[model samples]
Target: MVLFVIGIIACEKRLDEEVFSELAPSTLFTSEKGLSSVLNSSYAYAHRPGFQDSWAAYHLASMTTGEIWGQGGSIENLWLSEIDFTWDGNHDHIIAQWTIYFNSIRDANIVLDNLDNEEFSNEYKQLTEAEAHFLRGWDYSELYNLFGPVPLYKTSTDDPLLPRSSESEVQEFIEQELLAAIANLPVQAPAYGRASKGAAMAVLCKYYLNTKQWQNAADVAEDIQDLGVYELLPNYGNVFSIDNEGNNEILWALPKDATSPTASQAIDALVFPPDYPRPNPNNIVFAARTYLYDDFVNSFDENDTRRNYIITEYVSTTTGEIVPGLGDDRSFPYKIEFDPGAVGAAAGNDIPAIRYSDILLSRAEALNEISGPTQTAIDLINDVRTRAGISPLTLAGFTKETFREAILQERGWELFFEGKRREDMIRQDVFISNAVSRGKNAKDYHKLFPIPQVELDANPDLVQNPGY
Candidate 1:
């Protein structure tokens, strides 16, 4: 397996030609090359040891079904419960998530603070600042969405204890940052790993859509579509192939190189099967909650190719294979495989934040919300369905409410395992109660995750959410 090692140069001194201490952020941010290095470092840190755990991806799936509970350890179980949790102040998962989010924020602040210096060009500096804004906004959005009313930090500070911001305040903050980022960012990033205007738009759509500002979300999604640089990949499965790097569908992705020294094993270990005799060392996988439902299984007619691509009844890897008809096999979505190693190995696939499919779905949903499901919405949905080789829904039998349900279900089918189910359910106003009867947790107060105890202990200024 090839690993991509980010070049680490000591930034202790300016190089007329000599390299210096690599660890110091201050030294690194002084030069153009050094500044870029600092940005890469921040990216590296996002996927580093303290940031993502198996729960990062698992939580998204765990909200669904067929996921093993006891296996992820106690933290997973605590999160799975439909009630408020009171974890120890030093719970590793909480601390890890808190620290990494802030760390990325701080790094972005450093970049924004220094990008305009004479050493960098206007274009590069503008792009750098845009990326920083996107990163900061993106980090806070993550915190706010999962754990409502999180502390907000504009500039990095030595004061480790920060207080929580109100949910409205946090949402406003994300929108503001993302808007500015959209303005400064390029429509298409020069590199696969960097943020772009489309990325900003995607985040804006997510931010507005989640907050129920459907009109705003629709407008921004339309803007992204107008960019004309992105499109749905003709082949549904190719979008996730390792060889399909920088495909037009991807708006923003966390660039992953298996060979990179800085890489962490990604969802592969969790998504792929474990200990199958044949595919033994090839794709290590895990099963999660958001497996599949009978409604979904029956929704697609025999000709719908998406059903084949999105839902898998059997687990297949380079190693051994379980017979497809087995009961265990039916529960797991075999689309993606887990690479075995430690608990969470860095899977080579780049994690996509937003892609063309997201825009299409968002537009369809937004149109439904605003104009009550017009032909435009139907066409857009069918566009994606056609790409997936699914039969198009004729407007004849489709009503606004029916299309809304279809759109959401289609999102469930299309975007499953892409870290979106919880948010989708919540946005559609189905999360807090519907999921409960559906064999999942959906208490009104349980909509948002609890504030990690460590944050509260560190700062008396922070208060727990209503339920917690």
Candidate 2:
């Protein structure tokens, strides 16, 4: 994707009366009580419309499907076209992402600025600042990866708008911020949703992985694994179930409170059984293109419980002939879970950001980059598969390259539809060429998403990406 500069709404210099007056600037620094609210707002931005559950997040995940949405006049169809530089101003993904990310950035900036003052004691201030930096880095890292370069905002300034930084500069800055954050942040936060040292390191690892800084990425993954706070869930199915939340296997997740409508809504209801009395645009009926491949669907042995848990034999009730149960062989494979009565609203099911399985694969990938597939790498990979109840492959037959390939396939199985396939393809250097071979309308220029035309027209200082 290309960098987009839009007319970002400026944040108020002072907090609004209704929201900020309760805690005046005087009160904000009087004690740690005022500062805790700052963290709450950051978490709120994370879950709100312009952020986490918004179109920006969802569409990024969906586009990896490489097909336009089946419905003729859908927002995602525009993304499919945009992937080939064939889209125009109506590109909702770009617009939504631009608005939400910038808004979140502004909020993070406010938090960072307020936390820098000396009113609070050094230790608490340092911890709070670490949290703010982690969030700021997270926002910039997303921008740097999806769009090549983005304006780096450190404070709320009244000066003229800044031009975008180079991608490398942005990435380096993000890495620095995460390093600072990891040092100051606690190993674990009081709440699961709050960013922790482990989470910061995980994000840092991803940043290195994206740039193909394999050695750095491996080192970071190793650091995260060394924390020992996380472990693989005994069963893959348990990881996705609502009951399984708060499981130690999850390093971090977006909090979805079912009681409060503002809390996270269950995501499965929207993506799963469409006709099961849910949202208006109920889970759009779609099948996994990869599961159709024999290597993926049948990769597991009969004893592999993950095969049954993760890949449900997806059956479309709309087909009107037969409705195979989720795990039935006749059904297709898909993630299914739904909250009835929440139409066009957020789902209650928690969206996982980092999990033990992901860590395992990251470790395997990093080790492969470091020394080909060492026994540790092979053992880690096999550990995941073994937990899935799949028969372990002989370590004697594994080579570095072969093991790397297996890890990729394993990721497809483990993290599918979790918004990672495209990044994985990009990291592996196969995104563009593979899409072209798959008959997608891709070109070398299409490797990055186009800068929305509206943004190009509005921001005179902004530059359009190559093919757009």
Candidate 3:
């Protein structure tokens, strides 16, 4: 599973468009208002309902880590491939994520291509281009995490039929693109959900961590801290609450519209069991359900406020009876709390794509990996621990190995259901073993999901991943 990292220190980091489909690129590129709408379209696709609900990170990745299970839906999802590790190219979640990444990239390219339009001022054009890069880089990371080196559609003109890029090319592209984005994005975003320096750098830090570029990862973490705009909010439970969407700790998020929220982003559809008493009587629980694996629920120290999201026992909505979580079966994920103003099941909670706490944890792990455990690493971890209402770990208690394991556990506790656990397990080299230990049929090759069968059929030049 070792990947070759090229001179990434030298190099630098898409989503949907609406009018893009209806109008010619030339026509759409003419006016400032027209161009702006195209850019907004990209955001819509990138931050669409599936982004938060159960696309890639939320289900496909988390399920592989043996942390959660999905059930009760006719619509296909990773739930189809959840427990057995039997998903193939046709897996619904796999195809959905693949489409999201490529389509997102396409839209970003559309925006970039139109940046030269004279209607917008030069400064506005530069900002627009940077925003395009940030989104394109974000989707690229999503694709790389799930599928390794996918076909590198660097821009819209890159042959649609081109085969996969070399791992190094893909890695370098991600780094260089993000570096460009970091250079252009402001320290503070002009508005909510917009990518900022912190968001772009957090992603670069993530790429560095996954590639095992320990020093680069640690360095980016420190750079984010230097921005002086981020900190862990005092309470873990409130971070994801619907009422606290754009709080200080959230570096960047996929925000829901206040007036007309997304229907598919109904995350509570999976979290609340049929009978769990929802604080909002108006919310609709969809057929889909997500239950925490009992072991994951039990792994947390009872004192960790983060554990508050795991609803183990609740008053039943219909029977007015108390229902206990079925061991290893039905503990719920209440991360995106019930949204009373919801369109149906969707919540107003802005799904956090990157957070301040992630920077601290990533830096701690990277430092430990680079030079073994250190006081700086310990303090970074303690920052998260303190916010979670848990006791801090002493430097004396951990060696490199133990610190690595502890940080991995801390990540699970603090960031589970936030779409980061798979990378954590993979970076820690336990992705497959954790599955096997839990009696799953995982293999080394299973670390990367197979390229979708439809993608292979449509683009003859594309090669499928090994063992698919």
Candidate 4:
């Protein structure tokens, strides 16, 4: 299996002449071990580093909103540019993310194409195929949201050039893939990190939300709640605690292990205060460059237990004195807390991509959209508020518009710094307006990021997203 793993790398590489010349799919997918290795490689792209420190999708999503700002330092301009909506197609972050998503899709396709290759048992083949479909759907979901209609590759191909699919076509493809994945995936994965029926349902719920399919979103979310396998953790803080990696609250998360390079999340090292204590000799300081915006800090009620995760001040390592964080420097998200015992950037804290709380919120939003304010919706919102130690909302004179606003705000407060802010803002149609209100020169065209210039250059069929 160890020797065959090299062939897995070739199978997962870019669909170009060099890779095709180097290795064929027959060489890698000839056995269960080989197919499994390539499938694992596909999952690796799920958490590409965004800038120098933060996860790319999470960082870009967080920075674009008014909730956060890049603390001034190295690559400060780059971060600020994204927040200001000034980044172009050539931005390295944009290019890197584009490659990650497409490469992930390609890798998933490789496994899907070879699933029937007679080298694997029926049980192993079904499970691996389900995992591949989920990965592909997940990657496409991210790519579709960020870059608009990207070239849809259903199978591995020798042709490097492809045209973009219509948004509707891509959406339908994602919907079908997720539906198929849901059928094959178990209600709960054998391990915390693997895909499951709940994960596929969660993704479908989000897709419905994104496409404004209100009733479908509501129904699917309700289906997830009815699964009876997930719930909100009693303590809000523990939800992100390293020890609570696979708590019931998490629907799907990227599993991290301190000793496994591929499994660890470096987010803690990137978010920890610059001078904070470290376990080893590495000067892995990326703290000051990313912090919560003052407005976001003030948005929280003092009694909200979730506020405990957002650090407003920290004691200096040099002076042993308390220092308050202010403005962009005032509040740092300590959500992924510093791990003094971690080796290098490897912090053993699983990053939740979808959680039960998120499903609850999305369901509430969809219900409100469908039938105004209903008790079921209010109860759903209240469930999350209660967990956050905040007073729950009542039905007293609640209009649909007001309830919608409240739910959106609730999501912002609950899911801050978790990489869903940008998507939330866009769904609520306030993404550009919020930036403009905060003095950013943002325009409507900034809603979707520019398709990377590198992609456009290599593929003649590609067009730069409008306003690039």
Backbone clashes, each candidate: 40, 13, 12, 4
Cα error, residue 166 of model 2, in Å, equals: 1.6
Error of 2 at 372 (Å): 1.7
lDDT of 1: 0.64
Q: How far out, in Å, is residue 202 in model 1? A: 1.2
Model 4 C-alpha lDDT versus the unseen true structure: 0.77
Better of 1 and 2 by TM-score: 1
Q: How far is candidate 4 from the true structure (C-alpha RMSD, Å)?
A: 4.4
Backbone-clash count (model 2): 13
Per-model TM against the reference: 0.83, 0.81, 0.92, 0.91
lDDT (C-alpha, whole model) for all candidates: 0.64, 0.62, 0.77, 0.77
Better of 2 and 4 by TM-score: 4
TM-score of 3: 0.92
Q: How far is candidate 2 from the true structure (C-alpha RMSD, Å)?
A: 6.2
| Model 3, span 187-278: residue lDDT tens | 87755666788889998999899999999999999999998888888888778877777788888787664334331366677666667776
lDDT of 3 at 369: 93
